[model samples]
Target: MTSATETETETETATDAASRPAPPLIYDGHCHVASTDFIPRQFMEDVAATVHRALEAQGAAPPLARLVDAYAAQHQDHDADALVAEMDAAGVARSVLMVPDFSLRMDCPLTPEEMARRHHEIRLRHPGRFWVFIGADPRHGADGIAAFEHAVTQYGFEGLKLYPPCGYSPSDERLFPYYEICAERGLPVFVHTGPTVRSLDYEPAHPMLIDRAAREFPGVEFILGHGAVTYFDVCADLALHRPNVHLDLGGFAGAALPDGWPTHLNRAFRLGLNHKMIFGTDWPLNRMTGGLTRLVREVTEGTEVFAGVRRREQALILSGNLARLLTRKGNE
Candidate 1:
């Protein structure tokens, strides 16, 4: 019944609304931008050569440099700006950057001070785009805690990152002081809880150890990174029981969901644990586009297949829920 001009005007308005940027609401709760430096040209070349030598051992083609070059072209050597560009393209608004395991390097050693300094610089350059998690090596004893305290006080770090079993186990009494400090200061603790490629004192990176910490320190917020990938059910059980415990869907979110994985996600949803589930891509290792797409698809499919879920619930899992949790209380 509308005139042609009126209809055209309405269409233009709708187009403009659609073109507006999607809510700047995404937060990559776990990532490792600092680890890019570890992937130097020499290291890549060494890995490539090793791959080629192994292949040649089996009478296969020797394409080491070619493969290395391809990966190198896709991602440069320790270029954070390029990472930022990739995040912008993929609609990620912010990333919580964590330091890599220091023990891996025999040379170019990274003490806690050095790690904190780099994080401060990165935060200064990127502002709100990058949030830092101070890395504390329990092996350093008192010195590590002092360094961690400095980072938290000076850099305004939001959380602490621990790679237990990388240098020590979560159950070790030596690390309890650090956990106490975090709890007292009301800072969140993010612990690696999955299969780690690097050599560590412990293997499998089980969530059970972390569960003990959760029970011990109910005040400190604990995030089980990778959603305790190999321990999703255990993580779900923890989330159900512990109000302060949360799960970070970092690298695991990008991978295709297994046959029973959706059930765990649905169980968390049913238990009203949506806000505790955060979105993270573990970028550079997994492209933001691929991670976001997989999350969107899985959440959408889960809602469709499950009885007590809706598409809006999927939106909560992707971004809305995280936005609420990450923001300080009363900000919402």
Candidate 2:
């Protein structure tokens, strides 16, 4: 019963819709839930203690317990509603939520399985808005391994996040089993590759510690989190030489020096490793400095961190590279 003119119009509209290019991807490669439930109480206490000692040294002392309470108060957004609103404002299409297992190393209420379930629930609540990277310390033994495998096989978690500062080398034999799962599943591995709070063991997180794993597990992609701001040259070198190794700009959220971030990033780009660079803001951790909008602007607009980067390359740094990594091999 449709008119010929109406049919023609509809056909034209469909063609136009199909022909239009997809929107550019703006992805946040790293972030976390700003909730105390996910972060361990012991970790909070350590952070509070570290800050207190630092302040006392500088002679700007505040009561220790008060500071601890303040730190606790900063993490109220359990559901990430505020984070989603901010991401929308910043034009971030998706984010990777990193849930590191602190149950073993710290006094945490939630076990590894419970934490993984919480992240899976968050992913379901938001659908395509978030991807999850789960962490399971090798010290958790068989139970931890089972929980990690379950998250990937049943819950559809995307990647693995390892915190070496929790006291284990990236090259540890215990982590090999996890690496095998990542290789088989085509999941990337993100390792904490630099200094953290004074509480954790810093020596274990040295950049070179990942070299052995990078050489051994060529099938799995290894991303050095906080690579930009910590051991920049060494991390860039690893990404430059190793086919499977890459770097994420997680700690650049608070680049204070005028030329600090740009200089370090340009060095990597100059080494022809632009594609190896993934844009990440350790959100909520750096939320005190600025919002996601500011972080996005610093990398995408004007003559700043991404000044000389072409549109195509900029696309890779912003989201294309991550999109490629996130694609499961079998699906492709």
Go through the candidates in order and give the clash count of each: 0, 0
Clashing pairs in 1: none
Model 2 C-alpha lDDT versus the unseen true structure:
0.84
lDDT of 1 by residue, 80-124 (tens): 676676667666777788764454333333555776787687767
Q: Give the TM-score of candidate 1.
A: 0.76
What TM-score does candidate 2 get on C-alpha atoms? Answer: 0.88
lDDT of 1 at 305: 28
Error of 1 at 313 (Å): 4.2
Q: Scored by CA lDDT, what does every candidate get?
A: 0.66, 0.84
| Model 1 weakest 10-residue run by lDDT | 100-109
